[model samples]
Target: MPAMRFFVFALSLAVTSPLLAEEAKPGSPPPERIVEQKIPPLTPPDHELDLLFAQLKKERNPQAARLIADRITSSLFYSGSATVDMLMGNARKATEEKRFGAALDFLDQITLLAPGYAEGWNARASLHYQMGNFPKAMADTAHVLKLEPRHLGALSGLAAVLSQSGRDQQALAALEAYLDRYPADRDAQKRAIDLMIKLDGQRT
Candidate 1:
């Protein structure tokens, strides 16, 4: 099998451990620790998303496309409720602190409080992915897509889940769809190409 590149949300950190790094033993080297942190993106005005999406579709410049995609992502985080936003912030902080359970709790409240908010589902999906709960991550991703079919993060996430499950064909299709919406995503484009080659080789 070809090496697969996993995708995570730009706004999220990829946490590999739920515990803090242990102190180095006497005369031993310190353990290397990887910590992932998430920076909450600003929520752009609702009226600007349409224009931003349009620009994203037509943007060929990598830098410009990234800017447009960031703007679109920002809008996705808008829940229109202060309470939900606060809960989401707490979830982010919890995740950063490696308090996965507490993060999940905050995420659960956010999802329940704003079931219509796609970001709530998206956030939970990211946490699940980080926790190696692919099934739950995929389920939350499905909810995100149902709420917002054009969600770039959800599309990429679905591809990641499918790829992890050994469903390369489905992953390729999902990634292609993501590229169709955001062509300037170089990483997704590369993954899509890799999948195409792998599948084509299987046909021979």
Candidate 2:
């Protein structure tokens, strides 16, 4: 009877010990393994500009394209800094009042404060152009283009600068680039055609 009891106890130990050991084992998987789920990365908020640019490229209607261009311009004007925006406003007022030196000072401060802001360079480029500083205007336009390659204003300004410098072929090429991005601009199309005609006449 003792032997029978011993045998029964051994059988119960053999059956239950492994499960108990496994549960206490270090780094052992639980009875139900939990899989860790991976999270997707968040998209950037600036994708709005990408969507707007895509819409601008696809829209064939001139009036609709103009409206889209206006929106893009408005978006570009926002320097993301209240101080810079205020300086820009002051620069505009100075320009309006023909206070060229004060306007330039404001623009200079804006560029220094926000070197990454393409709008500051663009505004400075326009001011330089108005002041007959073509070289400075051209340099500022180059900075604007580097910061925002798809900037319609910068592309147009680049073309204008090239044309004024008497580089007609280069001017036409720049205009062609502008038209490629925003083909619905009637004025740009006319200007491109005019440049082509002018180039053809010059060749003769």
Candidate 2 has a TM-score of 0.77
lDDT of 1 by residue, 14-92 (tens): 3123555666679997667656554333334556876887889899999989988987888888766678889999999
User: Candidate 1: where are CA atoms >4 Å away?
Assistant: 1-47
TM-score of each: 0.76, 0.77
Q: Which candidate is the best by lDDT?
A: 1
Q: What would the TM-score be for candidate 1 when compared with the true structure?
A: 0.76
Q: Scored by Cα lDDT, where does model 1 land?
A: 0.80
Report the number of the highest-TM-score candidate: 2
Residue-pair clashes per prediction, in order, are 0, 0
Clashes in candidate 1: how many?
0
* lDDT, residue 60, model 1: 94
lDDT of 2 by residue, 59-139 (tens): 999999999989888888876567887999999999999999999999999889778788899999999988988888878
Lowest lDDT sum, 10 consecutive residues, model 1, at 2-11
